[model samples]
Target: MAAFIIRRLLQSVLVLGFMSLLVFVGVYAIGNPVDILISPQADQADMARAIAALGLDQPLWQQYLIFLKQALSGDLGRSFAYSIPAIQLILERIPATLELALTATGIAVLLGIPLGLWAGLAPDSWPGKLIMTGSILGFSLPTFWVGLMLIMLFAVELGWLPSGGRGPTTELFGIPVSFLSWEGIRHLILPAVNLALFKLALIIRLARAGTREALLQDYVKFARAKGLSEARVVCVHVAKNIMIPIVTVIGLEFGSVIAFAVVTESIFAWPGMGKLLIDSINVLDRPVIVAYLMVIVSLFILINLAVDIIYSLLDPRVRIGEAKT
Candidate 1:
């Protein structure tokens, strides 16, 4: 297990190094730094000063080494447009995005798993058909469009919730809170649901398929023949076996949710890293862009690592180098 973990960590480092190289190359390929340094009214001395300030006068290798050093030291530098520390800006907005992603993921798992189990256990039944239909619609619909429709129905037409923003300005239970208020919750509901829709569909489909496969296995047949209760056969016997694949999907989806929050956040005017990244990109803010990219890549790698560890835990055969059949 320790060897496996260490190996994975080393691979993660290599992946990060390669990812950094790709980002640097891509950003540099977009345009020359000279364009940014030279304005219409700038003179020779002004251009030279700007070039020196940005370290554009240095060789490409030297510039890359300096950037790498600063990044390693957790100094992501200042945003070219905002004139603020890139790391600081990202840290400030991270909480909202994390909250949204977690909330949506939780909703997806909670709703998707039970529905999936039901559908899988009763494959040809009406409830199974309904679950399948819902999953299909969810997978087919775009998140942004779903969000818009939700807002239109729940916020505008019904007038039950605010169309956008975090929450109201008030106290709840003697705590200074807004999102806890009814209006705030109403505003959050649609966006959260929209975010969860696709994830829910994926989970349900994976779960149903896994359950079906598990139910057909010889071990499940043996359990049934042994006269174990149907619930025990399904929940304890089948569900446990189905978890490995479901865990993989959940982890991947969770990682995607972090980076993919941009569009949803934009639609709802939610203050998050997604909005910050978009804003930085619009203004060609290198520091902010780089920082956002690093955060996202790191999160993705970490999630996959966690998934690997989880797989080992769920199936001891994985830890022992036994091939998965």
Candidate 2:
């Protein structure tokens, strides 16, 4: 298990390096750095200083090496637009985005699993057919449109919740709180539901398919023949077996939840890395853009590693050479 983990970690490092190179090349290919310095008014001395400041005077290979070294050390350079350390800016925004993603994922899993189990158990029933049909439509709907509908129904029409932002502007229990408080949970409802709707649909379908397959297996039949109660057979024998594939799907979807939350954040005015990345891109803020990209790539690799470890624990057969056990 240790060796497997180490091997995966090494592979992730290589992948990140390749990703960084691709981002660097893509950004540089878009325009020359000198153009950014002399667009409005051309001044020879100013141009020379700007070129030196940005390391444009250095060889391309040397500049890339410097960037790599600084990035590895967590420098991430200063934001060309913000005039602040890029890493610091991203770090400040991390909590809000992480909170939103985590909240949405929890809602998705809680709602999706039970619906899936019911649909699978009663595949021919009206409730089951309805659930399946609804899930398909939910999965096919665009996220931005879903967010808009939620805003209209919950915020504008109903007036049951705030239109946008994280929370009410107030304090609780003598403590100052922003949109991140318990009162703020109401604000999170629309955005979280919007973000989770698609994932919930996918998870429900996957879970239903997995449970149906497990129910058809020989072990399930044997459990029934052994005089076990139907509920016990389904819960202990069938559910356990179905978990392997469900775990895989859940992990992949959870990773995607974080990756795709950017658009949802934008629509709902939620402060997160996704919105920050989009804003940075619009301004052509290279430092912020590169920093955000690195953070996202790192997260993707980390989530996959976590999934692999969870898989090993859930199924011993997945452990390296563990089939011999």
Q: What local distance difference test score does each model get?
A: 0.83, 0.80
| TM-score attained by model 2 | 0.90
> Could you give candidate 2's per-residue lDDT for residues 1-325 as a string of tens digits?
7788799999999999999888877776666646653566868888888779877788767877889999888788788767899888888777667677777888878888878888998999999999999899889999999899988998899999887777653444543334456678887788888888888898789779978988898988899899999889877776676677767877787777776788899999987788888888766677788888888888888888888888777777876646483
lDDT (Cα, tens digit) per residue for candidate 1, span 62-112: 877898999888888777766688998998787678767888999999998
Measured by TM-score, the strongest candidate is 2
Give stretches of model 1 more than 4 Å off.
32-48, 168-184, 320-325
Candidate 2 residue pairs in clash (backbone atoms < 3 Å): 167-179
Please report how far candidate 2 places residue 179 from its true position, in Å: 9.3
Give the clash count for model 2: 1
Q: lDDT score, residue 107, model 2?
A: 81
